[model samples]
Each structure stands twice: as structure tokens, then as C-alpha cells.
Target: MIDVHMDPQVLAGLQEVMEGEYPRLLDTFLHDSEERVKALRTARGDTQALRQIAHSFKGSSGNLGAVRLALLCQRLEMASAGDIGGLVDQIDREFAVVRAMYEGELRRVFVG
Candidate 1:
């Protein structure tokens, strides 16, 4: 049962590959992603800025196995001045979910 929100295999690979730093990596990605999501809000309605923010956010999200959110950002990256507000709202919502998921993983695996 793969969640559309993320890829468990990718997350597992990152955990294995990163060794002890996996927690920190998730922490950094979450922090950086929060800023990017906020930037998307602030830059809404500006096609150029939205594309740039979405592009970077897409890369980071993909790297972290945020499958669905990465796809949302990809859509935003290619947006053509159509429903920018709606797309930003979608990205904002997705990021919130991703952050919570990662935070939960941190607490359960790292803290327990």
C-alpha cells in the first residue's frame, strides 16, 4: 500500500544510505521545504517567481520521496498564469501534510 503522498522505498533508501544522518536530513528538508512553501504563498500571482520556487521545491521534494507534492510543484513549475492561487493553495496544503509525516517519522523512529 504505497501512499501517493510519498514513496516508502525512497525513504527507506535514504535512511539506509544516510546512516546516522538520516534524521538530520529529514529535519533539513522539512525546514527548507517550509520556507519554500511560504515563498510560494508570498510569490503567488507572479508566474516567474512561482516557477522558480516550484522548480526548486520540486527537486527537494522528489529527493525526499514526496511523490505527490513533487508532482504538484512540477505542475506549478509549468504553470501558465492560470489559477496560480489555487495551485499555491494546493502546494501549501501538500507541504503541511509532508511536514507532519516527516515529523512523525522523526519522533517515532528517532525518539523511540
Candidate 2:
């Protein structure tokens, strides 16, 4: 089965490379993602701002192997107006799923 929410291989590589800092990376990613989503809400109606935010968010999401979220962000970046609000909502929804997965992983890592 292909998991569109994330790429486990990229995450595994991150774990191998980050060692003790992996957890911290996850924490930071969640926090930053929240902020980005907030920015998206405020940047509505400003197409350029939306594109820039989506571009930056896409890079971070891609770096973290958030495959689906990154693709949504890419779509936002390329969006020339039209249903910006709906796209932002979609991105937010995808982030929620990704956030849940990361939070679950964190709990297991810390609790087990």
C-alpha cells in the first residue's frame, strides 16, 4: 500500500541522520506547520502572499516527506487565483492528517 501522507523512507533517512535530534525536528515541524496554516488564513485575498507561503511551505513539507501536503502546496503556489479559499482549506485538512500521524508517532516514541 502506498501511503500518501508521508514517505517512510525519507522519514527513516531523517531518523538515521538526525539521531537524538529527530524528535526535536518533529516538534519543530509541527509548530512551524501550525504557523504556516495561520499565515495562510490571513494571507487570503493576496495572491502573491499566498503563492509565497505555499512555496515555502511546500519546501518544508517536501523536506519532511509530507508527499500529499507538499503536492497541495505546489498546487497553491501555481494557482493563479480561483478558489484560493478552498485550496487553503484542503491544505489545512491534509496538514491535520499529517499532524495526527506525527503526534501519534511522538506519543509512541515517548511512551513506549
Candidate 3:
């Protein structure tokens, strides 16, 4: 099983600074992540496209403290000479786990 954890310190800092915009920030990250995952799934055998997508996804996920997701993206980005399909599948599965965690966090913060 993959472990999913968001950085509490990063989240607390965002909440401190973002204030009312915190929910929106969460929503945006979730939405953008969905799009990036789709792009990764549809990248086929295009290494350039896959690398570009993974690099961008890595930076944003790291910014939001999704450390595991960012690390997965980093692996995908560096796998220009290996099995791209396998990495994409791994990313898809892992993103599902990460997405669930983020959604739960959003509810805890916004709905509770």
C-alpha cells in the first residue's frame, strides 16, 4: 500500500496567509491535479510530453506539500529512457490515493 501524507506545516502556513482563499486553493489544486493526471494517462509513448507534464505536476504538488505525489512525478520525469507505460500506470494509481487524501482534508477543513 502507498502512504499518502500532506505536510501539515505547509498547510498551516497556507491557511495563515491565504485565510479566506484556502478552500479555493485546495479546490484549484484538486482540479488541476485531475487535469494533469488525465494528461499523463493520454501521453501515450510521447516522452517529451510525458516529461513536460510530469515536471509541471511535480512542482505544483510539491508546492501544496503532496510530497509523495511530487516524488512520483519526479520519477516519471526522470524515466525518459525506461518503461514509460509502467510509470504512468503507477502515477495513475498513486494519484487516486493522493486525491482521496486531499478530498478528505478539504472536507475536514471546509465542511467540519
Candidate 4:
């Protein structure tokens, strides 16, 4: 409902993509988001893989309309050089909220 990161064009594109296999899109988002979160959980913020993970999540989430989570991912990416332990928990929580909301809406639109 809140198209924070997704503009009308993006939403339209998403709708077109989901015209047939909507469940697949939802599954992909869930799986990829989980992987990104797991990467953040284990990342020590010094490795290039960690930075890549954050950047990937930021771009992916933004494309999927999870603006807040994408922003957090950007922050994590930017702050990857520092001790991100404390921010990890916060990011996880926020990501979860966005994930849930996005899933709920996705279901409503696609599965309803």
C-alpha cells in the first residue's frame, strides 16, 4: 500500500511480471532477503563479501519496494567499515517488518 521505494512505473512493471507466476516472485524475494540478512548476521564488516551483500540487498529491496529496508541496507553498506554489531539487530528487526508487510501485500495482490 505504501509504495515508498517503488514508483508507479516500478509497480506497473512488477504487476506485469507477476501477471502469471506471482508466487515465484514472492518466493524469490523471501529467499533473497533471508540470504542477505544471514550474510549481514555473519558479516564482520571488513570483507568485500559483506559489502557486496549489503549493496545487493539495498538494490534488490529498493527494486521490490522495501524502501526502508533498502535504506538500512545502504547504511549498513556505508558503515561496513565500522563495528556494525549493534546496528545488525536493528537492521534485522526493521528488515523483518518490511519483509512481512511486503509479503502480506504481495499475497493480497497476487493470491487474493
Candidate 5:
């Protein structure tokens, strides 16, 4: 089976430290990730820019326990050295999954 998208232990630890700010933290990650993805999509032939964005994004995703997303970002970062175009679609799809999962998590934590 695939590993869980967001690590429960990490989330629990974050909640313990962040308390009521946990939801805001999630919201900030979601918003910033969305912008990073958008910039990645539009970066086109700018390999240096793509690599920089992917590098930063990978760290944040990993911190948030989105291991798969971080892996995808790593791939994109590496691919930026060569054929970044070929990886764009895959990155977009994986990010869609990540976005949906995080949105669900946000609703669960903040609304439910």
C-alpha cells in the first residue's frame, strides 16, 4: 500500500506545539504551495528559477509531512537540469492530489 499522504505523527507534533495556530499554519502552507505551483507552471524554460522554486517548496512540503509531494518536488528540481518540460504534467497531477488531500485535512481540522 502507498504511505499516508500527511504523516499523522508530524501533524500531531505540530498541533502540540502550535496549538490554535495549527490551522493557520496549514492555511499558509496551502496558499504558498498554490503560488509555488503556479510559478512552476509558468516558469517554462527558466531552469534556474524552476530549480530554486522546487528546492524551497520541497523543504516546506516535507516539513508539513507531504512526503510524496516533496518527492515530486525533488524530481522536478532534478529534472530542471535537463528535460523539465516532460515532468511538468506529472508534477501538475501529483500536486493536484496533494492539494485535494490538504484541503480535506484543513476542513477536517478547522470545520469538523
Candidate 6:
């Protein structure tokens, strides 16, 4: 798993655009994440839907500075073209990380 760093440089760039809008952005990410997860779950027998949902997830994560998650999603998206049975656990784990990160960031911005 790639270490998704919320380094100064990365956060600086995200902060530049996010600014006081972090909460909204975080909400968007959360909504998108949930939607993607649901799509992925229901897409078990549909390879195309799986690929598309993964791709969409990758885009959303990238937009939120989640490079690692985006990469994982991209990998899953590509792997969906083949057999996805073996990748389920890994994908679920990564998705958990992404969800936690998003939630944590949101909490920091809103509660701190």
C-alpha cells in the first residue's frame, strides 16, 4: 500500500484551493466515496460497472489529494478487467483507509 502523505507540500496545494471550503469538499468526497462503495458492492457480477466505479473513485480521490487511494482505485479499476475475486479484500482495506482519512480530515477542519 502506498503511503498517502498529507505532507505540507501536498496539503499546501490542496489548502490553496480548499481554503475555507474544506468542509464542503470533505462532504463531497464522503458522498462520492459512499456512492462508489455502493456501486462497487452491487457490481459484483458486472465487470464494466466495477471498472467504471473504480475509475470514478480514483478521480474523486485524486481531486481530494488522496494519491495513494487514487492509485489503488486505479489499480483495482484495471484489475477489474480480469478477475476481481482476489482483489476484494485489498480493495476493501484501501477503501477503509480512504474513508478514515477523509473523515479525519473533515473532523480536523471542522472541529479544530
Q: Pick the candidate with the highest lDDT.
A: 2
Candidate 2 has an lDDT of 0.90
lDDT of 3 by residue, 1-112 (tens): 3365578788889888998888899889999999999999888678999999999999999989888888888988998557788888888877787788888878988876
Model 1 CA lDDT for position 56 = 95
What's the TM-score of every candidate structure?
A: 0.93, 0.93, 0.90, 0.77, 0.87, 0.81
Q: Candidate 2 residues 18-82, lDDT tens each?
A: 98888899899999999999999999989999999999999999999899999999999998688
**Root-mean-square deviation of every model:** 2.1, 2.0, 1.9, 3.5, 2.1, 2.3
lDDT of 1 by residue, 2-77 (tens): 2589788998999999989999999999999989988888888689999999999999999999998999989888
Model 1, TM vs. native: 0.93
The per-residue C-alpha lDDT of model 4 at residue 29 equals 85
Model 5: lDDT equals 0.81
**What is residue 56's positional error in candidate 1, in angstroms?**
0.4
How many angstroms is residue 46 displaced in model 3 relative to the true structure, after the best TM-score fit? 0.5
lDDT of 6 by residue, 78-102 (tens): 8834567555456666777777776
Ten residues in sequence with the least summed lDDT for candidate 3: 1-10
Ranking by lDDT: 2, 1, 3, 5, 6, 4
* lDDT of candidate 4 over 1-112, digit per residue (tens): 2335434466558868878675577668878888888888887645577668878888888887777677777777777455466556766887778777667767777666
Candidate 6 residue pairs in backbone clash: none
lDDT of 1: 0.88
| Clash tally for model 2 | 0
